[model samples]
Each structure stands twice: as C-alpha cells, then as structure tokens.
Target: MALSEITTRLTAAAQAHGRDASGITLIAVSKVQPAERVEAVLTEGHRVFGENRVQEAQGRWPAFQEQFGGIDLHLIGPLQSNKVRQAVEMFSAIHTVDRPKLAKKLADLAQERGTCPDLFIQVNTGEEPQKAGCLPSEADGFISDALAMDLPIKGLMCIPPIEEEPTLHFALLAKIARRNGLEGLSMGMSSDFEKAIAQGATHIRVGSAIFGERVPG
Candidate 1:
C-alpha cells in the first residue's frame, strides 16, 4: 500500500469516529527499511517517522536529515536506560517509558538539557509478561511520578496481544488516558489503525503497510 492510501484510510477512520483526521499523526515506522524506501516517503512529504533502535536511528537519520530538512522521529520500541540520552537527543517523542527508573532517567535528561521529546507512558494493557510496558496496575503511580517530574508527557501507548480482541485493549487504554487527562494514544499499526482511531488515537504508527515488510538482517 502507498502512503497516500494509508493516510486516506486513516483520515476516513478518524472521520468515521467523529475525529478530525488532521489531529492524528501517522508515524511511518522506518526501522530496518531500505533507505530508498524511506527517502521515497520523505520525497512524498512524510515528516513523522518511528525508529525502534536508537543505534540504528543514530546511524540512519543524520544523513537523511542532511538530505531532508524536517523529519519528526519517534522511538516506538523498548528503551534501555543507557540509551535514554541518545533517544532523548534524537526522537521527537518517546513511546516506551514503562518503569520508574526509565522515567527518572528521562526526567534527569530533560532537566539537564532543558528539553525533551514528548513522552507516552507504555501500558501493558494485556498484562503480557514479555512485553515492555508497565502493568496496568502500576500505570497510575507511574504516570503520577512522571507528572511530578515535569516531564513532557503527551499521552499513553500500548500494543495489544496479537491474538486478542484489540478493541478491548484500546478501550482500556482510552479509559486510562481519560482519567489521567492524556489525549495522545499511540496505538495501532498496519493491521488495525482504523480501530485505534475509532478509539480516539491521536497518533497511529504504521510501518509495513507503507514501506512493505522488512528483510530480517
């Protein structure tokens, strides 16, 4: 699928749910894609992109930026504490702050630099043991702690268990965001972004649907 088609669908999804499509930001997940594919999207005027690995982004984006002046990058994968500084410097947003220690590290970086990317608290809505988000039970306190640090927390993010009904998880995430006064919901991907928008997703991360599947290295 092309970027325009995916964008049109996202817009339609937002409209169908009484949302302004313009309010939702589509992040092109560019991790592991060929440079030509990414450059093609940039040529089409896509500014928002997501990268899973800080090291990969460090090696990739600089040259791309030299070529395309405005790129809004996001970190949509698990973040290690040691990588926080690089992630902070590189991404326009960080969507995987799942623990107090990670949050504290981000807070300290924001303090030292006087600027930080917009943040989203990752909630393990499905209680998936192997996933990277904070458990649902731990989210409230975690969000509270982040707020106290004056972090630029924009909203919440979640990746539903692949086999479950995503609507249930999306609704749960929405409920959590509402209570916490968060408007940004960084959910959804190539397969179910429409559903995410229907549940009030302010940002949807779409990758393979746009760039095609990655060739595993």
Candidate 2:
C-alpha cells in the first residue's frame, strides 16, 4: 500500500476507535527502512518515528535531522546497559528501559551531562522470557527507582506477543501506567493500533503499514 493510503487507514482506525487522530502519535518504525523512505514519510509531514536499534537510529538520524530540521526519534527496542550513554544522547526518548542497571546508567549519564531524554519503562506484558523488559509485578518498584532519579519518567511501553490478542496486553500496560501515574502508553503497532487507541495508547509505533516491507538489512 502507498504511504498516503496508509496514513488514511491510520486516521480511519483512530476515528473508529473513538479517538481523535491528533491525540495519538504514530511513530513510523524506521528500523531497516532506508532514508529515502523515511524522507517520503517526512514529506507527508510525519515528524515522529520509532527505531529498534540504537546504532541504526544513530546512523540514520543525523541525515534525517539535516534534511527535516528535527524529527522526534524514539528508541523502541531493547536498550543495552552498556550503550546507555549513547542511547541517552541520540534519541529523543528511550522506550525500552527494562532494568535498574540500565536505569541507573541513564541517570548517571544524565547527571554527568546534565540531561537525559524522556524515559519509558518497558514492561514484559506477555511474560516472554526472550524479551527485554521487566516483568509486570516489578513495575512499581522500578518506576519508583527511576522516579527517584532527577530524570523524567514519562510513561510505560510494551510489545505484546505477536500471536496473542493485543487488547489484553494493552489493558495491562494501561493499568500499570495508571497505577504508577504514568500518562504515556507506547503500545500498538501496524496490526492492532485501533485497539490500542481505544485502550489509551499515547504513542503507536507503526512500520510495515506505513513504510511498507523494509528493505532487507
């Protein structure tokens, strides 16, 4: 499908979910997509994007910024504790903060540099052992730990298991966010974004639907 058609579908889905299209931000996942495609979306006036790898985001963001002035880049995948400093520097927001070690590293980096990007704790909503998020039961403690630092804790994020119904996962994240006083829920993607919007997803990461299948890396 074309980019314009994708945008229209996204808008329609937002509307069908009883959500104002403006309320939710569609962060085009630009992981393996080339800069030209990203530029195409920018030409369509998409200012926010999500990327899975910090290195990938770092490599592409500079040119995108040069051309687009300042696009909002979100780190939407597992963030290694070792790369916290660079991750803190490159992206506008980090959505995969899953452990206290990484959190502390981000906090320390922020203290040294006097800045840290918006932070979102990634929760293992699906309890997938292979995933890179903290389990749901430990959310409050982790959020509290991150909050104690001077860095801003904006909200929570999760990637539900691909095979399951997303509403259950979205609802779980929403519940945790509410309990922790978090306002942002970065859930949903190409397939279940409307369901996400209905459940109060502030940020939706869309890839295949927006950019089409990625060019193989």
Candidate 3:
C-alpha cells in the first residue's frame, strides 16, 4: 500500500477511537529493506522510521539523512551494551531497552556524549520466554531503576505474542506505562495497529502494510 493510504487509514483509526491523529506517531519499520525503498518513502515525505539493526542503519542512514534532512530514526530492536554509544548517537528514540545493565549504559553514555534519545522499556507482556523484554511483573522496578539513573525513559513498548489476541497485550502495556508515570506507549504493528491505537498506543510501527512483504534473502 502507498504511504498516503496508510496514513489515511491510521488517521481514520485514531479518529474512530476519538483520539487525535496528530498525537500518534507512525514509524515506518524499514528493517531489512533496501536503501532505495527507504529513499522512496523519504520522497513521499514520511520522516519517522524504525530500524531493527544498528549496523544496517549505520550503513545507510548517514547518507540518507544528509540528503533528506529532518528525518527521525528509531532503534526498535534489542540493543547490546557495546553498541549503546552508537545507538545513542544514531537514533532519535530507542524503543527496546529492557534491562538494568543496558539502561545504566545508556544513562552513562548520555552523560558523556550529551545526547540521549527517547527511551522505552520493552515489556514482554505475554511473558514469552524467547522475547527480548522484561517480564510484565518486573516493569515497575525497572522503570524506577532507569529513572534513578537519569535515563530518559518516556514510555513502554511490547510485542504481543503472535498467537494471542494483541488487544490484551496492548492494554497491559498501557497500564504498565500509566502506573509508572510514562506517557508514551510504543505498541502496535502492521497487523493490529488500530487496536493498538484504541488501547492508547502513542507510536505504531508499521512495515509490511506500507512497504509490502520483505524480500527473502
């Protein structure tokens, strides 16, 4: 689908929930996509983008940002401690911060480098053993620890189990954010973004619906 079509649908979805569309950020998940496809979206004037890998973004975004100013890049994947500095420098937001060690690393880097992207603690709302997030039960303590360390945490993010109803997970994430005094909820994807919006998602990551299927390597 075209970017306009996606935006229209997103706006309608927000309106349907009695929420203002302008308050919702649409992050185009550009992971694994070629730079040409990214450029095409940039050409369409969509500025916010989500990338899952630091290396892939480092390989392409420097030039893309040089050519197309005002773009916001979000790192929406698991981050390693070793890459904290680079991720802090490159992304406008880091949405998968799920542990104390990584959160402390980001805080130290922010102090040293004087740049800190918005942070979102990823919660494994469904308690999936394989997922990259803190368990739902640990979210409050983790958010407190991040705040004590001066990490610029702004919200909570979660990837619901594909087999479960996503609305339940989205609601859980929103609740976690609220209990911890967070305002941003980075839940939702191409499959059920409208439901996410209804559940108070401030940012929705959509990829395939707008860019089509990923080309298998």
Highest lDDT scorer: 1
Q: In model 1, what are the clashing residue pairs, if there are any?
A: none
Compared with the true structure, all predictions reach lDDT values of 0.93, 0.87, 0.92
lDDT by residue (1-217, candidate 1, tens digit) is 4999999999889888788888999999999998889999999999999999999999999999989988999999999988999999899899999999998999888899999999999999999889989998888888999999999899999999999989899999999999998888999999999999889888899999999998665
Off by over 4 Å in 1: none
RMSD in Å for candidate 1, one decimal?
0.8
lDDT of model 3 at position 197: 96
Error of 3 at 175 (Å): 0.7
TM-score of each model, in listed order: 0.98, 0.93, 0.98
TM-score for predicted model 1 compared with the true structure: 0.98
Report how far residue 208 has shifted in candidate 1, in Å: 0.6
Off by over 4 Å in 3: none
Using TM-score, rank the candidates from best to worst: 1, 3, 2
lDDT of 3 at 205: 98
lDDT of 2 at 91: 88
User: Which parts of model 2 have CA positions greater than 4 angstroms off?
Assistant: none
